[model samples]
Target chain A: MTNRTDFPPPNANQQAFPPPAAGNQVNAQNIQDALEKAVAPKVINTSNNKNDGLNKCPRCGSTEISTQPGTGMLVCHHCRYVFEVAVAVFKDPKELIGEAIGTGAGDITIDETQVTIKCQGCGAEVVVNIEGSMTSRCHWCRQVLSLENQMPNGAVPDVLLPFLLSRETAKQHIEAFAKKRTFYANSHFKREFTTENIIGVYLPYMVVDANVHCDIRGKAGDVVRKYTVGSGDNKKTYYDIDLYDIGRDFDLAIDNLTVEASTDKLNVNNKMNTNNIINSILPFDLENAVHYNGNYLKGFNSERRDTNINDLRGLVDAQVRDVARFKANSTATKYDGGIKWESQDMDTKGSQWLSAYLPVWLYSYMQVKGNGQKLLHYIAVNARTGETMGSVPVSIGRLLFVSSLIEVGLLFLVIIFFLFLVF
Target chain B: MEALFAQLLDSVDLTQVLAVFASSDEDGVGAVLLLLLGGPAFFMFTYMRYRNTDKRHRHEIETPAEMNNLQQYNNFIKHLTRQSSSTITGANDNVVSGSLLSNGGASKSFKAINDITKNFK
Candidate 1:
């Protein structure tokens, strides 16, 4: 597909970017360079920084350094300089031998983050890389991107989904989702939940890996309840509970745990920016996730994941606690009244970090808020599995009407049953 | 204050409550009779039968939401195919949601990676 000139040039990774922010922009040569990088070059040459999105040719200063064939690398236009871009090292948790149980028990060490890259904006080196992959922004000048010598394929992802469910289908999904709420939805949402306003987008997320080993010690109880008829009218009730001490150790490996990387409305702080319907649209098949080359995201809207590993530690923590809690509960269920969890001790073993791109087919809206806030509703499908999740506009009148009908129906049922008993 | 004590005493033993009824001491003793006879019996029966009922429900609920035998089989096959080829590796069995959904004897249509390519090359 021919690249659009009207839009900004693509990145070497093929991950799409929002239009350039404010004043920061890259030259035409950068776009050309990025486009050239999609298919690798036969000979290693580093001559110019052609019109690529964010890549540069180190040799003869030509921004047009094409990628080496079969390998997504930068080749010089004048001199044959072959440099392999460092990809993220993926370690699946299920493959690991031992899993840690809780948090803070491990000797944690991070790769020194002093690695810096040239900022297309300030022409200075900026630091990046927590796990892998240079970001969309230049650290020094905070520029959106400088496609000086970027190859187009660099902006493509290993896996991508073209939009499914036209705006009409998306609108329908949103409307259905909103029908139940009696209150707390935006006023304009009901009226504006139409198909005409939908836009397709690709959001970024991080799938994390960690081997968890938990040593849990807790109390579980089986509750037996019975009633004894007393002499005369005396009645007594007692709950017989059997309690015990429990300890267990199990290794758990979580694969593809996710945290959003996009800075859009569906961010950590603003769940409303994107519709929550996406949560119900579970289980996009990630098994088909190919390697990240970044060329597929051409005309669509895409955003980088703003949340980092540190930011998503809470998600991981919650997951570990859940496992521990489930384990405790399952053991306690051997008796009754469910188990009362008195205390828990957990630890984290070894964590493996991977950056993978998951596929989504989204149709959504962005509504401006009171103080320049934006709220959005989405009808999204897991492009790989067609698992649809969506939110629609709910009309107050419709909700009240439906609620009254439900109430009336319930009242009718109660009356019918009452009459049945009476008759 | 008197009401609280009466309730407390009522909770502890039923003989006195029954004695009060036999004696016809209170005007609203009628309400107490119905509750004393009705509520406890219902609760006891439910508690006694909880295990069998709970097990039955758990077993029945796991059945896929929408499918006859043939349709469910087809859906399962389709799901497996999508999983094999789709880029959505996360859409595997691990996730509870979006696993299987069928309607009226037909299998759910899942999106899958139609084309195959190696990792981000």
Candidate 2:
């Protein structure tokens, strides 16, 4: 079996990932030079396959490099040196935004689920399965193989947020959350709740940075006078509010606004799984995000982005408008009474889109209804920050019984008040 | 749509609705007060009841075999504020200058969000 090359053949029209520069200056041609610089000029892994691993230690030329768990750093066992992965950056952020908005999600149509790659280490023909795993091991040389370049099915992301929190830390957070939520949670859930069930996963997300122009027109209320009229049954409070037409215009630079890039986790209708709870744990530190490396995904489970940028355009637009409205409201907080925003328009000046894999620790429990309908309740903790949120399945009978008693007590108090007045 | 409108029109009974509210000790006023103040509390309780009833028979459960779950979302507003403050301060003027159409930066692109010139006396 012949060995595969390290990177895919460079596409003429595709954008390039800008390499780290001396002055941080970037242009389209510089980006191409950086891309070439990041991949080539040395040990060609003799493999012509696209899915072969590129984990060779650049220092000692040894293939014993592996990613250190909890930290995304690739450590070489042979040379005892750390290798830095190259992050892809564009020359102009504006061009990135234009491409994202102009091109729909169907940019690449990859029909094949697998790629044939011959291992450079042992000349063994290793079949890289894109459907499930990103990497494989050569049966002959026992060297780890990886998918080195961007795949057509969008398996490899532009960047990734590595897991910073250790397995022990994630376990502690999960255990604490389960213990705190055990009171109202289903009995079965409590019985099944164990720290052993918590697992680390890299979920797909789209990181968006934008320069937005927003215009908002609305009516705001300025309070003039307040007075109390009448008493007892005829008691009334009146306010004279002066209304004025208000408008605001501003340019906003938004960064690291993330959206779910996969459809399975984005599904809101799934009663069995609290998928929204998983979404609530976003806002990963995109600045700390590193260049995509297959070695970093060695031990963890990762989901590739199945959904496209076009599918989430409407959602991102709504979020942008929401942020714009919020910013406008900040300026008008002096109108404490309230402002009713009637019309809002947000125009995209420029934007950037990059796909990433964010880390998460998750534990879920399933509760079935009497009618055999199953619902999955999820408790998720941000693997990095240890912040926790979950949907706990609770007993309706107990809650209803308690609430009804309270309602009855309130009715009794009302009846007593009426009797006292009559007397 | 026609059927829905017809059904809604047929369901309206002003006198019957008034009588039900009037049955309360303080007449319709007490019912109105209850609706205005206690509606949310009652609705929350009803929602809990429904959720509780629905989850009584859940069966197969699946979760991760190892502890890898949730991460805290950073404050995005803080990031936005920092970036805009930099623009105002011209901190990244070089980068901004390189990107803008005429090297004028964000100033040329600014437009009033709510233009209220015509309505003023």
Judge the docking of candidate 2 as incorrect, acceptable, medium or high: incorrect
- Candidate 1 residues A139-160, lDDT tens each? 5554433322222222222232
Candidate No. with top TM-score: 2
- Each candidate's clash count: 114, 35
For model 1, the stretches where C-alpha displacement exceeds 4 angstroms are A1-89, A92-198, A224-239, A263-275, A327-336, A365-375, A405-423, B1-121
Question: Deviation in angstroms for A368 in model 1?
Answer: 8.8
What tens-digit string does per-residue lDDT give for candidate 2 at A1-423?
111122121236632222323443458986575445333322212122334465677798766666665665778877888876664443243222222321112334775668777788878788887766778888888887888666557677777767778788888776776666454455666677677877777888776666555556656655555665666666545565555556555556566667777877655432334565675565566677776777777667777788766556555564555555666665666554466676666656456566777888777777776667677767777766666666666654554465577677667767777788789
Error in Å for residue A135 of model 1: 15
The DockQ-derived docking category for candidate 1 is incorrect
Off by over 4 Å in 2: A1-51, A58-72, A76-97, A100-108, A270-272, A404-423, B1-121
Give the range where candidate 1 chain A is weakest over 10 consecutive residues by summed lDDT.
A99-108
